[model samples]
Structure formats: structure tokens, C-alpha cells
Target: MAPVPLTVPRRALDIVVALALLVLLSPLLLFLTVLVRTTSGRPTVFRQQRMGEGAREFTLYKFRTMRPDATGPGLTSGSDPRVTGTGRLLRRFALDELPQLFNVLRGDMTLVGPRPEPAELARRFPPEYQWMFRHRPGLTGPCQLHSRSHAALLNGMPDPEEYYLSVMVPRRAAMNAELLAHITLTTVVRYLARTLWYLLSAAWDRSGGSSGRPGGDATRRTEEGRSLCVRS
Candidate 1:
């Protein structure tokens, strides 16, 4: 696939909105920083190497939601022992990802694009899927939203990287390509609205005392020998 020409106007808008959001959310960011420090102890921010556009590597940021030494293989499960009580709350409310607004501001990410993958995981993707690398990774994208409720269940299982590479990546790539095909102000607004809705809905569910499913039956089926191939 040929690289899509990025629109300067849209990129400028993304930058402006990201910077504004960082400024507006400064107080909340500070509070979360203190909470993480008090709960997880030091290193309020978590940084990890993630594969970016054109297969370049970049450091991604997030609010620390695990013990300082929680690093290992694969993704995080909801029941992971490394997650602190505060961390669970942050994850539930998606507060753990707030720090990525900096990523958006820094040009390392976008408000909407394919979610970045760890370098090791990216290595497992086939060459065709690597086409996703043509665009900047995003803070909130199709795959992130799609997999939001299943992280814990998926992370706990063996070879979960297959789920991300085989299932999530293709779906995300399609959605991202669609987004690029129709990249416009209206689409961006709609994407922003959907992202906000998901966040607010998650917050409401948490406040209403709901235990969101760790994994859906469909996800289980995919894990249980079902093909993860995406239809063209």
C-alpha cells in the first residue's frame, strides 16, 4: 500500500487539541501523579518502547498502574497481581492512559489511529499487517476500544500475543485505513465523541458497581481455536 499523504491542517488541529487538553487536564494529571506515587511508590509515569509509524521505535507514556518492576512478556491481565488497588481503579476509569495526551502533544501519537504495539509484538505481525506502521500510533483507536474490556482475560492466557496480532491488529488496521480514507474534520469530531462516550460509559459502569466482563464469549471463541483472520 502506498503511504497516504497526511493533511497538514488535520495534523495542526491534532496538535492544538492535544496541547489544550494537556493544559486543561493538568490538575487531574497532578492528582493522579500523587495517587500513583502514594500507591505504587515512585515513578508515577510508566514509559515503554513502542513501535511507531514507518516501523520506527518510540517511547510511549502512561500513568503508572503497576509496581515499578511489573515488566515481563505479553499484555496486562485484569487479575494481574502487579496492579495496585489504585491502579485497578485507574485502569477501570481509563485514567491510567491520561498521560498519553503528552504523546499526542509530542507528535509521537495521534488522538485517533491504530494503537501502538510493543516492539516484540510488532515483530510477530506479518509483513502485510506491518502496513499499519504507515501512520502514527494513537492514544485511542479502534483496537484499544474494542479490546478495552478483555485485557485481563486475554493477558492471563497463553500466547495472548496471537490475539493482538491476528485479531486486533487487522481489525484496527482496517478501521484505521478507513479513517485515513475519510480523514476530515467531521470524522475526527465523531471519533472524539465516540472515545469520550466510551470513557464516560466506563466511568458510569464503575460507579454503578458493575464488574465489566473480563472477556466476552466471542473473544473466548477466538482464543479457542477459531481463526483470527480478518475479511477483506
Candidate 2:
């Protein structure tokens, strides 16, 4: 199923929330933009094609974390060599994604929906998982909330891309489908609150490198997060 309709109310909420966020976070956004520009050189904001609703393609924006001239596999774990010091911190705390609020304002995305899959990754999804494209992609969702943990897992993988496509992709599709199938206002609210907490809490992690990989408190928190959104 495509989930209950949130067309009118959801779009309204997305606009109100997105605009508020953009305004409130403007200073930090400017700082990060300048930070990336100075360190990585021009084009501080990274733009790439991501799959949207109905498999349509649209440009997704984020602060550039990798070297501007980087030439490596597209799928990267946080620990990848191409990631800059600023890039690593931005990725760790998800400050790089603050620009995606613009994506929500533009109607290319929603505040809560499936994580926008890359075109290549979406193309490789199994037939059963194709239903995920029925809705616009999200700034945050079930899969997105635990992205840190997922990145941590990918860090330990010898072949991250292949493992992600083979294991993580299908798992995410199923989890996202389940949540969307029963989505509601409260579900959306919980997700947004949880996402904020997840992002803010990342600051407490003192890991010099790596995404605070799964272990001890990290594992517990990941499990707690997973349990939060998997329910109706």
C-alpha cells in the first residue's frame, strides 16, 4: 500500500516546518557553506541526482564533504579517504543535510517519507521494493533516522557498496514500506522529534574518525532508535 494520504495536510506542514527550519538555521547554514567553500574550494553545496516519487529524478543538495576533485566509488562510508575533516564532522552530525530543507520547500520532497535513494541504488531495487517510489522522498524517515548506525556498519564492511545493495537496501525497503503503510500524524511527529534528537545527540560522540561505529552505547542507541519507528 502507498500509505494513508497526507497530501493536503502534509504539504502544508512540510512548508511551515521547512520554512521555519531554514530561517532558524540560516546562520549555521551560511557558516557551513563558507567552511566548505574555503576548505574544499568552490561549490560548497554538493548536488547530485536522486530518485524521487514515481522514480522521477531530481537534484539533491548537501554540503560538500568529499574533495571537490574526488574520484572514487560513489557509495561511501563515513571513514572513506575522500572525506575531509569538515566533511567527516558534517556527516557525523548530519549538518551537511541542512540544505535539504530547500528540497522540501521546492515540493521535490517531504519532511517525512522514504530516504531519497540514489538513482543507481533505486534502479537496482527488487521488484517488490518498487512501491517505495510511490511517495516523494523524505528529509527524514525510519531508515534515515538510523543512518549513522548504518554508516557505521558500512564502515566495517570490506565491500560496502555490494553489502549495502544486497542486504541494507532490501532491509530498508521493507522497513520503510511497513512504516508508510501505517503512517499517521503522530508517527510523523515522533519521527521528526526522534530525528532531531538523533542529530543533536551526535555531538556528544567524541570519535576522531568513523561514525561512532556500533558498539556499547552506540549499539544500544541504534536498537532504541530502530524500535521507535518500526511500530505503527
Candidate 3:
């Protein structure tokens, strides 16, 4: 398949929205930085290398939620012991990922797209899955949307690494490919709106309120899985 051209309009939207959010959320970002520093110690921001557009590698940033010498394999299972107290909270709300706005600003990522995979992990994807990387990785997208509760799901699994690689990775990659193939302005807007609803609903659940449904807690449980992977 031919590579899709980089979406200039998408990049422009990413830049505008990221810049506006960075400016608007500056105070919260600063407070979170200080909190992470005091709670986790030095290196307020955690940087990890992720595979980016066209299979390039770039440094992805998040608030330091784990200790400097955190142990365990690459996959973070639910409630892994390495997470700091503040890190757990940050991961719960995805505050840790706010730093990636800079990555979006730098053109390494976008507000919505496939979440970037780690370089080594991404390399293991099936050959057909590679095409999903033609555009910048996103902070929110179909993979992220579907995996909202993955951390909780994988928590205490026999081997999170195995399951994530063998099961989750392929499924998410296929979903990403589908999203990429059908990408459009309307689709992007719909995805963005859905993400907002998830965040809001998750926050509402965390506040000890119900949305008047039988599976309300289940939804919250999934949102709690935000930290189950990289940030958890």
C-alpha cells in the first residue's frame, strides 16, 4: 500500500489546540510538576523513547510517576508496586500525560491518533500493522479509547507482557488500521467528542456518583486502567 500523505490540516489543528490547551492548563501543569518532584523526586518529567511517524523514534514525556529505578518489565500491570503515591493519582487521571502537549507542539504527536508504541514493542508488530504509523501518534485515538480499562484488566495477570504482546497489541493495531483507513474530518471530530465524554464520565465516576446505569462501576473500572500500561 502507498503511504498516506501527512495530513497538514490535522497537524494544523493539533498545533492550534495543543497550544491553546498548554496555555490554558499551564497552572495545573506547573502544580503537577512540583507535586511530582516532591513526591517522586528529581526529573519531574519522565521521558521514554516511542516509535513515531514513519517508524522514527522520539522521546515521549510524562510526569515522573515512578521511582527513578522502578523495577518490573516494560508492561505495567494493574496496581504494580513501582508506582509512587502521586504517580498513581496522576496515572488515574492521565495528568501524567499532559507533558506530551509539547510533543504535539513539536510535531512528534497529535491530539488524536494512534498512541505511539515503544520502539522495541512496535517492531514486533505484524508486517501489515506497520502502515498505521504513517501519521503522527496521537494523545487520544481509537486504541486509547478502546483500551481505557486495560490497566485494570491486566492487573495481576499471569503475564501482562505476554498478553499485551500476543493479544492486546494485535487487536489494537488492527483497530488503528481500521481507523486510519476511514479517517476523515467528521471521524476525527467524533473521536475527539467521544474521548471527552469518556474523560468526563470517568471523572464523574471517580467522584463517587453514578450515571444511573447497571454498568456504571464497570466503566469507571476501565478508566482506572489508564495506568495499567506505560504510565501505570
TM-score, cand. 2 vs. native: 0.84
| Clash pairs (backbone) in predicted model 2 | none
Deviating ranges (above 4 Å) for candidate 1:
1-5, 152-156, 206-232
lDDT of 2 by residue, 169-225 (tens): 788888798888887777878899998898777778675434322111111112212
Off by over 4 Å in 3: 1-3, 206-232
lDDT of 1 by residue, 15-98 (tens): 999889889989999899888777756666666667787778877776666555554335665555656688778877678778
lDDT for each candidate structure:
0.65, 0.71, 0.67
On lDDT, the leading prediction is: 2
Q: Kindly provide the TM-score of model 1 when superposed on the true structure, using C-alpha atoms.
A: 0.81
Can you give the lDDT of residue 223 in candidate 3? Answer: 21
Model number with the top TM-score? 2
lDDT of 3 at 200: 64
Give the C-alpha lDDT of model 2: 0.71
Candidate 1 achieves a global lDDT of: 0.65
Off by over 4 Å in 2: 1-6, 156-158, 208-232
Q: Rank all candidate structures by their lDDT, best first, as comma-separated numbers.
A: 2, 3, 1
